[model samples]
Target: MSGSRSVADRSRPVDGKRVVVTGAASGIGKGVATALVQGGARVVLLDRNVDAVTAVADELGATAIGCDVTDEDQVRAAMRGAAEHLGGLDGAVNNAGIVLNEPAESMSLVDFNRVIAVNLTGVFLCAREQFPFLADGGGSIVNTASMCAGIVVRPQPQVSYNASKSAVVGLTRSLAAEWADRNIRVNSVSPGYTLTELVRSPELAPQHEQWSSLTPMKRLADIDDLVGAYLFLLSDQAGFMTGQDIVIDGGYTVW
Candidate 1:
């Protein structure tokens, strides 16, 4: 068998599967959606950025719905909207998050709450709404966590971001355990400093060179590089894997 043949075989379809991806307008969420579509799942994009979400859905021929995940009502409505648009829902990726840099001593309550609202509360909202849709036949869920959840950060502070993401890991484990008998698999992916909008911030740009050098891969990850783990968790390949956190950091956490 040729190498090309093996590659082609690996690209098999995930037909008849339905997936909802929040934060689908950009970054890692967008990449995950694209990969699901390529693998033959029908995808519904939920994003607070209506225009970008619609544009991406149009480009991918998937359905798009406007949603502010931090709001319970909006999150419920968005989940319903996606279920209706896609005819059903089988899986979800809770990838919506926000980050704010502040020294712990100086971090205001408002800033801290904002990050927690979107990164942590948003996950709760989505998972709460997803239950009814996913319970029947069981389904998969993958949350976007961060390397900061497991490792310490230095030089730049994201105390709020780190705390919220750590909650995500806890959420994944609890949900996975609760839903295990029901066959609803739950997992999380923790990424290190990857090439995303967050990395281009003026505050963090100076550290990019250091971050890259620190990684064993010696490069920042492309958003797409995280897709395979998602596909696995959503597929039978990882049917037995749940309540786990998969770290994809280009080996940045090894040291």
Candidate 2:
């Protein structure tokens, strides 16, 4: 915000970085976007929920768009808008997702497909669209996979969710390899049970309690706990890293 700042002060890992975050209207998306803006990144917040995203963006002095990641046209359009707002893209966070806890046998195909579309296909679309904008400068992409990707020991059934997230790990690796030549880095952050609005739901209380108990930390992770990993991956600090899944599951998958 001031021109008197020195280069080092202005060039902090996320400082002045142009980034796009999906699902920025609420929950984890909202938390990450807030952190980025505070850390000096110019963020373009995208979400299907127009009203909510607009409000949040305005509050943070960031740009906002009402676009669905599942739609190619909207994804392209959102990227275009982001470029216009931030001059160009430097990084992206594909954090848009949904969850359905139901028996695999009884889960309707429609329900399973919906979760995959948002959690899996959505990330693919966001990354693909943002690739062109980021390729010129060689940037970073962080997708939100879950501890469920590796551990499915919970009593509740999340077959579809687990399957989709596991695929994200594979997806991150493949993209990292392909983009490495362009100086682009791709990675994922697998968060443990976090205390977000969604996770704190009355319906999810039992699951939260169970996960909290099982976690080695004996407590759930806060959204802020996962921000450092994203910032590191987006910054030059992780210049040598790519195609890696940084698991921040509070040692949940270690056992």
Candidate 3:
């Protein structure tokens, strides 16, 4: 106990950290940004939906940037802008992603490539651009993967999504190993079916019951349920962790 920090000190692990979150217009990204702000971190919210993200940032008293992660130039510029706003970066959450539920046999190449461009290549671009800002003092990068990365779900043919997410894990491990020397720890979070705006839509609501029953917890996760993992990955408490994926699936993958 002589060298130990108090629980109070440990409780606000991300306090004063400079952080950035992509896809911050809604869903998990917005949830994480809100938590970061509440935890006393300086945050920059980026999303392709400029107006929406701007509103969220304004509400949270954080900076906002219009960025499309799949575009390299945009990613680079957004990172620079975020670092400038934060004065430097301590952590980043690369969470911009889209899923297309089409069977592989009928899925057009254009559609498949779109998913890869955003979910896989976009992550690479963000991490690459964030390197310079973080290299000086070291930082963390949390990529949002999905439980689909590990196992294919039934009733949905999202071959592209599954493939892209699986690659994210591989990318995370590669970056973690390569950047360990620079103190840039890389990690990923793979969430199970979560209750996001899109999921609550009338078109997708019918599928919720099936998804919930399959989960061990008998329900979908709230955005709140997954934000803690992101906060931990970006905090000093997880200082020794890297190249790992924290799956927040409520035991869905346990089977």
Candidate 4:
């Protein structure tokens, strides 16, 4: 009669959890949504690109909603739609981001503010709308940040990107603390040099290569490679985890 228990003591786990993933039409968001679906969760894919989102949603048989993440009204409507379609919302991935790569000197206020608005304000808007839905089920949130949050990513100075992602880390922690009593866990994943369509662009590939070389892995990460971390954060397996930024940067921050 010690601390041991029978096999039945184990919980049924995170199967059947309903999660909303923004920017799910492609890249890391799509990968996370796909992984969650394969693991038996109901996923709602929200993206600004309606056609691509529709195609992906059709392929995955998930509910798809097209909305601009930066628009508060659209973000709220999307969350409402997700709640209505999924019957209830359990979690969300605030992964919609825009990258503007230019030298800081040449970067204009308009360009800088645009990136901040989408990357930082967008995450806040999504989370603000999603909290009530998720609180109903007491769930987890995993935001997609970047290695630039903690590290000095020089040579290709994306000052706005760096600032926005750093703010994400802070926001995740703050929200985690604020909602701990409600059993709403908040966390983030900071991926480094992830290979996406954006990375493959002629303007970004060389920078991507440079960043990849900086990582100990010596290669850029596939979007799928970041899936496990998201899964773990959203699943009950990480129940004790909150207010943490799980860096999946292949040791890029070590230097």
CA lDDT of each prediction against the hidden true structure: 0.89, 0.89, 0.95, 0.87
TM-score of each candidate structure, all chains considered together? 0.94, 0.94, 0.97, 0.94
Model 3 is weakest, by summed lDDT over 10 consecutive residues, at: 1-10
Candidate 2 segments whose C-alpha is farther than 4 A from its true place: 1-11
Which runs in model 4 stand beyond 4 Å of their true positions?
A: 1-13
Best candidate (score: lDDT): 3
Per-residue lDDT tens digits of candidate 1, residues 105-203?
Answer: 999999999999999999989998998889988999999999988877666888999999999999999999999998999999998887887778898
- The best candidate by TM-score is 3
lDDT of 3 by residue, 1-255 (tens): 253766875989999999999999999999999999999999999999999999999999889999999999999999999999889999999999998878899999999999999999999999999999999999999999999999998787899999999999999999999999999999999999999875676656799999989999999999999999999999988988999999999999987
Clash pairs for candidate 3: none
Predicted structure 4: lDDT: 0.87
lDDT of 4 by residue, 149-235 (tens): 997675776889999999999999999999998899999999988888757778877677677778888888888879988988887
lDDT at 38, model 2: 89
Backbone N/Cα/C clashes per model: 0, 0, 0, 0
Backbone clash tally for model 2? Answer: 0
> What order do candidates take by TM-score, descending?
3, 2, 1, 4
**Model 3, TM vs. native:** 0.97
